[model samples]
Target: MVLHVFHGAGYERERVYAARVMFEEFLGLEIALHAGQEAGWRIVRGEEEDGKELRLADVLFRTPQGEWLTEKAMPSRPVPRWHTGGHPVKAPLVAPDVPVLYGEEVPNGGYLAVWDGGLQIGADLLGGAFWMLTRYEEIVRKERDVRGRYPAFASLAVQEHFYERPVVNEYLEILWWALRALWPDLERKKRRFTPRLSHDVDWPLMGAGRPFFQTVKRAAGDALRRRSAQAAVRRLGGWWRAAAHGDYDGDPYNTFDHLMEWSEQQGLRSAFYLIADHSGAGEVDGDYSLEEPWVRRLMRRIKERGHEIGLHPSYETYRDPRRLRREFDRLRLVCAEEGIEQERWGGRQHFLRWEAPGTWQAWEEAGLDYDSTLSFAERPGFRCGVCYEYPVFNLLTGEELKLRERPLIVMEQTVLHRQYLGLDPWEAWVLIDRLRTRCRLFDGEFSMLWHNSQLVDQGETDLYRRLVETM
Candidate 1:
């Protein structure tokens, strides 16, 4: 069925984007946008019935003077304060107490007003969804953390303490509630809760390529800095075993088997984003090389066991389209040699460093299928404001790209790293649990990144096993 969206003039880019996401991606409906003299937005069914028109407010990007995309159009500080409706929009439409982020505050509480013929949604939820899906704030707000990523603290969701909530999904849910109430016959694309698992193979093996003396040095580091006697002994044991029988399983960091085993039992596919090559210092690409014999063996094993191999584009490649392309080609070449083939290849950026549309554009140019790299390293939860994978739109270019975004919702280091959230294991699980619950609320995909290197601790490993079971 066709849904004709009549929207206000100006910000054609913004209006089209919002409509496309709400109607096509979110509602699973064919949609077309038409500019109207009306102040707000309206969606009319192609075939008129009693439940024909669904009116929604167009409160955002509607400047009194001329246009949007200026400094004036950005969400103000203390952003996303509620605009409630006269009648309560309850569970399934929105989790209780969830407030409208962007809309006019009316006596109707500004969420929705049910009438005899149809419903009038007071919230500019489509516009709010657009603001989030495009990451409108990341472009206008020029503040970046030391790592050159837009800090989560600066984001509207986090600034207003709604990062844990999937605002876009909530907005979509409200839209669906209205749409379904209006068009009971309309059906949305079926979806199920999926655990999108990935392992960024940052540090593959502990002693695969290192000399014996270097292994001793690492053992010392494990004891002194890492404060793990078991890790130290395991490091030495792995080194000696590699020397004696070429077995590296004693290496605590050699957790690929453990990772694969759990996923295999759960009947889930795990993606390993490999570093194709490194051009910078600090092991930005990875400590291990793809050319290593053991690395190639691991790649072959992953494919043999039915896991995936994807590119972990080097640190500097985010801006360098040429570098990204070259690294992807190298990954493909190595995969070809290893006799590994995947229907689609996608991965995260190393260190979670990304520059909105530019990085997305590079991925599109490189011909990757999707990227799971939009989560904040400093905090977890709804960085893209939705858990489902959706086709990306480049705000700068005023065009959409085929490279979909399966947004990274949780990463191990983001929660466990001492300099980051630094939460204890139980605390980390609590936070991740809430996020997963929210994703499940919408039947959305929960994209999680757990590095093979970080699973060394037995306690953390146990936690992951539990996570896999529950997920």
Candidate 2:
């Protein structure tokens, strides 16, 4: 069935495009874009006519009579409602009279609701979804961290107290309910949400790849910085084991084999992103070389065991297509040498350093299948307003890129380390469980990242183990 959308001249093409994506790609429905008026299941930007229609104009669409299309609407704000089963939600799209058990409301706008036999939504859901999906706020907001990334605190969701919510998915749910009421015969596909586990081999082995002097310097620095003799002694022991046995498997940072074993025991697979090249200056990448014998052996082992090996593009490659291509080429060469032939590849950027459209364009140019780097470094939540993997769009040009994005939901360090949230193990576990429950609600993929070096901490390792087991 083709759902006809009647967009007026005041409607932006990008908004219409986003709505089309939501309806066709996400909702599995056919859309027929039309101008002016049309027949059967029509969506318009003005007050309802004498016939069947739905209104999604409000903030985005204007009437031909030179008047605003909706009621005196205000900018969306968090509406701390008792519904959503403890999940955060923006303003609701249904009326209070409809008896919606799960929804929110704005001040004067009431709830975003459907009228005229479910033919209309009173709010600008398409606009809201478009804004969230394209990260429209981030594009317009001029906030950046030291690494040129948008911090979580700067986000509209965070500022509005809904960063923990997947608002786009909630919008989709509103759409789903409307569509079901409109067309009862529509067959919607049931989605099964699953956990996507990935590891960034930032420091494959803490002591294995570093030069002897560098290792000694790190040990001494630890002693001086923390003023702890025990830490100094522990670092020395780790270095000795790494140097003598050529295998630091017993060391906390060298947890590759353990990771594989744990995954195997859980009957799951994970992606391992290995850094191929280090940056020249003013940037830090992993110390290990992709061509190192031990690294090669590990790569081969990961692939042999049915896990994925992907390129962890260096920090400098985030905006440079040429640099990204070169790094990916090196990774491909090494994988070929290891006799691993993967048809499609995906990865994340080092330090999560990315520059929106530029980084996305670079990933497409480098021929990556998907990228899982759209999350906050300082915090963990729905970075793109949705938990499902979706094709990325260049919000600037309104062009859809070839690359799909599996947005990272959480990173171990984001919640655990003192540099970030500094949550205790139990607190971190509770947060993860909450996020996972949200993912399940939408039947969306929950992507997680754990640095190989972090596994050295028993608390982190146990948390990871619990995470996998619970999933």
Candidate 3:
């Protein structure tokens, strides 16, 4: 099916990109945007060969294009007013009470009117989608945490407290419902809910990666603070074995076996993003070398077990294209030596530190196929307001790149860490289940990050098991 999208002037490139995201990318249908016409007109869907047609007239939705002006782009103090809450949509796949964003609300109950002659839509689905997908807010807003990363609290999604909802998906569903209403026989691209598991190898071998003083300090804490002699001994033993015998697997964070075994049990392959450079990786970011025998052994095991090894750029590489390229090359060179012939290369940014199209551009220029680094570190919901993997477009360059974004939905730390969502195992389960259910509702892919070092704690290990089993 070919959808002829008629629209008025202003933001032609933006409109084209957003329409592609809405129709071609999200809905999996062919579309053509016809400009120079009154946008408050009709959308015509037809068969190219037979010339059969259907039309939805009177488009009442209009994007506040003026808001894009540099000075006025930022959301106001009362952000929730600009966001739709419990908005009703007619998509058969999702709940009737769904959330939306950035679009003006009409008096009608539904998000947009599915009329035969009148305005079929009054919500700016394309505009809202474009705003969220391109992360327009992040670029306009400069507020950052101490780590120089965008703070989750400042995001429009969190400001409106809809961080847990994939509003972009809801927007697409509204558009799909409108199309299906006009042509009942319209079939969307079939999709299945997929669980994409990944591990960021920040501390693959906890004993070997830290400074001696730091390790000793932590050992002291294990004994004095926790009052556990056995724990202290075990920590010291891990350090000794790794240092004296190169037995890095003896370290508490060397839980690669457990990860591979669990994924195998689930008939899944987990992606392990390895840190390839250390130029800007502070002590806290891990100091393990990819050239180490232990890391090489681990990589070999991962490949032998049919898992994936990807690049995890160092802490400060996100903003530096030269550093990014050097790190990527180092990883590929090591992979080639180990006979790990991966057709595609991709990974996450350390600390999830990214700077919009710049980081994305660096990845694309460095020959990476995808980047799963779009999640907020302090919050683990839809930072990009999406759960699906879609090709990204540079809002600055106004050109689509080859890199696709696999938006991270859940990071173990985001839920388990005391500083973030701060949920217990049960609470974490509830929150994760809600996120996963949302993905299933839209047949979207769910990507999760669970650091190997986190599993050293038995309680965290058990929680990890439950997450994998449930997925």
Residue 82: error of model 3 in Å? Answer: 11
Error of 1 at 294 (Å): 1.1
Predicted candidate 1, C-alpha RMSD: 2.1
Extract clashing residue pairs from model 3.
Answer: 58-119
* Model 3 superposed RMSD (Cα): 3.5
Question: How do the residues 35-131 of candidate 1 rate in per-residue lDDT, one tens digit apiece?
Answer: 9787788888876644568888787758654345556876566564443443555436334555455677544564566777667876788778888
Total clashes for model 3: 1
lDDT of each: 0.83, 0.73, 0.78
* Tens-digit per-residue lDDT, 1-471, candidate 3: 677777777677777787787788777898777886673434676645333333332221243565562436553444323222353445644344444444344456444543443334555667667778888877878888888888998787887777888888877776777667566788888888999999999878656555678788878987898776766776788888877886767788889998999999999899999998886556756878888876898899999999999999998887899999999999999989999988878899998889877999999999999999988888778988888998898888888888999999988998988778788888888888889898888889899999988886677788889989988
Q: Give the CA lDDT, 0 to 100, for residue 47 in model 2.
A: 37
Measured with C-alpha atoms, the lDDT of residue 74 in candidate 1 is: 65
Clashing pairs in 2: 54-119, 54-120, 92-104, 93-112, 93-113, 94-112
* Clashes by residue pair, model 1: 84-109, 84-110, 85-108, 85-109, 85-110, 86-108, 86-109
Per-residue error at 383 for model 2, in Å?
A: 1.6
The best candidate in terms of TM-score: 1
lDDT of 2 at 428: 99
